[model samples]
Target: MEEPGKIKLTIPCRLDHVHLAGHAIKGVLAETIKDSELVFLIELAVCEAVSNSMQHAHGCNADCNVEVSIFLCNSELVIEVTDTGAPFNADLLKNKQCHDPEDATCEKAAEGGRGIFLICRAMDEVKYKSFADRNILTMRKTIKPTDRDGEP
Candidate 1:
């Protein structure tokens, strides 16, 4: 069993596995929070991150494991996706902005590279690292109280 504020689930790095992960996460968020929009955003961010690993990191050649850890603290949701695969080019994402959707560059037209862009835009914060043969991507989104006067 998980603690009150944390949930951890692991799924195989297969195309179908993404659906299970998404469903589990969405359920948890729904049960824990009253706001549905926030829940959907978190779910989408996680799905994209895991999908990227299944498609690009594993190259669809070998079975892989994706470990998802979600924790809620002070109304903030933190999600991490970790996988064992070839190291990713973290520099490419950090150095370049998401292609202007209208840009006609070859890289922008490619399917594989756009996953990171979607992940970045979907979450409030996105970070990546390659450590000890694992690629870890962490995304964070905060849920502000409806009465709060400040912007999230």
Candidate 2:
């Protein structure tokens, strides 16, 4: 099937606004993914990633904004969350969250650090990059094939 589309969104950096990304992603991907569980996973992962950017990225400053972009690439769903805040060390997140609390450092604290772990767990693939201008978190998941019209 030919790659058909993408959706991009920007929201104010506030906890209250995190739900917008979840709703937007589910709306956009609904045509391609019919699994309620997978939909929940996408929404959860997107919300967590965006929440991390808003809460930790800009010090939870509500004035800032978080950007989310979802695209169909290589027969997979690719989601990217970008922010203007200081970049954290991605190498620090190479491993999943440990069961023991002591194993997590300040960077991977159990609180919101759980978001990073969930994002990595839900999506088939996850990536992050701390660029000079912005930090980007990329997550990908392959969806079940749908009709050519993009209807599941």
Candidate 3:
């Protein structure tokens, strides 16, 4: 049974399956957030998290599974992505190397860390930890009164 104000989903570790989670996130956030871009960014952050779990943590292993939990409390939205494959390096959160997309000097070889960087940029808070065999990545965003009330 799901808790009130929360939605949870489990998906096989596959890049193709990531979109289902994204759609679910968008559906939930779109209800109160009138901003389509904000909704999209949240969805994108989730998709990246799921994709990283499938590709990095699970090594694209179809046998593993990823769990996503979303919670809406007061004006905050919290999301957690969990996997059992491998623990995430929490240190990366402190040293995310973000590049300016418009900078022509940025090297394409910097492909390794953009996912976590984007996730951090999109959410107000992002955290990762592992205990026993479970690794959980939690993300949070606070919706302003104007955002929820659709006030200009």
lDDT per model vs. reference: 0.76, 0.82, 0.88
| Candidate of highest TM-score | 3
lDDT of 1: 0.76
Q: List model 3 lDDT by residue over 33-80, tens digit each.
A: 887888888998999999999998999899999999999887899999
TM-score of 3: 0.89
Q: What lDDT does candidate 2 reach at residue 9?
A: 91
TM-score of 2: 0.81
- Model 2 spans with C-alpha error above 4 angstroms: 1-4, 97-112, 146-152
- Candidate 1 per-residue lDDT, tens place, 39-148, comes to 67678888888888887788754467888989877768788888888767777567436653675777657554666776776678888999888899988887677612
lDDT of 2 by residue, 105-142 (tens): 88765463567777877898889998788999999888
lDDT of 1 at 64: 70
Residue 87, model 1: lDDT of 68
Location of the lowest summed lDDT over 10 successive residues in candidate 1: 143-152
Q: Residue-pair clashes per candidate, as listed? A: 0, 0, 0
Report the number of backbone clashes for model 3.
Answer: 0
